[model samples]
Target: MKPELQLSLQFADARHRGALARHRVARFVRAALETSGRIAVRIVDEDEGRTLNREYRGKDYATNVLTFDYEHEPEVVADLVLCAPVVEREAAEQGVTLEAHYAHLLVHGTLHAQGWDHEDDGEAEAMEARETELLAALGFADPYARG
Candidate 1:
């Protein structure tokens, strides 16, 4: 059974107005959740994305997705921030659909909120395996598959 989720979605960047519906986002999130959660997912433009990344992660550029996880027990409480333009660029570069990319990132962020990480080779492999499994279950191709 999928874990219960209370999701609050926001689109600071209107460019993705019709793309990321609440049900779709929730489906992506729930697929990676091992516990119930209160998650806020925000989609932002490059500037806001860069600013948040710079302030929170000390990185000067916008990243695809950032998970600010506050809790992992009983219930996971976190915020997932996705950079829209970056995601679009990546999808185009990777030859994947925008919907597929969004699903991948939401799953990635949800896993992070549930305490998954890819800080090293072993961790990365495991995390990727998990992500692959989850994505496949959702009928998506392996995100890390080599061409």
Candidate 2:
């Protein structure tokens, strides 16, 4: 069953605007939803991404994705921030399509919004397995797979 979702897609960085269409972003996010949710997916430039990470996570560099989860009960509510440059670079480095990488990140972020974490070995394994399963269901290859 597909979980109900209300998604808000924003692009602070227009570089990847053509790549991230509203319906496409919604599809990626919805694929990871286990329950009804209100999620905002924001695509930002390196500057904004770096600032957000520095402020929120005390990290000095731009990251691929950041999840600001507010609620995780009957309905999940959260904001997912994706750094365009970082994602693009990582996709190139990993030899994957930009869309594929975005899908993986969205699934990973959505899971975090629902309280999934990888702080430990066991948690990391479980979360990665779940992500791989969900991505596969969406017709994506295992994100953690290495050749």
Error of 1 at 26 (Å): 0.4
lDDT of 2 at 95: 94
Tens digit of lDDT per residue, candidate 1, span 55-90? 999999999999999999989999999999999999
Residue 101 lDDT, candidate 2, scale 0-100? 98
- The true-structure Cα RMSD of candidate 1 reads 0.7
Cα error, candidate 2, residue 90 (Å): 0.2
> Which segments of model 2 are wrong by more than 4 Å?
none
User: How many backbone collisions does model 1 have?
Assistant: 0
CA RMSD of all predictions: 0.7, 0.8
**lDDT (C-alpha) at residue 41 in model 1:** 98
List of clashing residue pairs for candidate 2: none
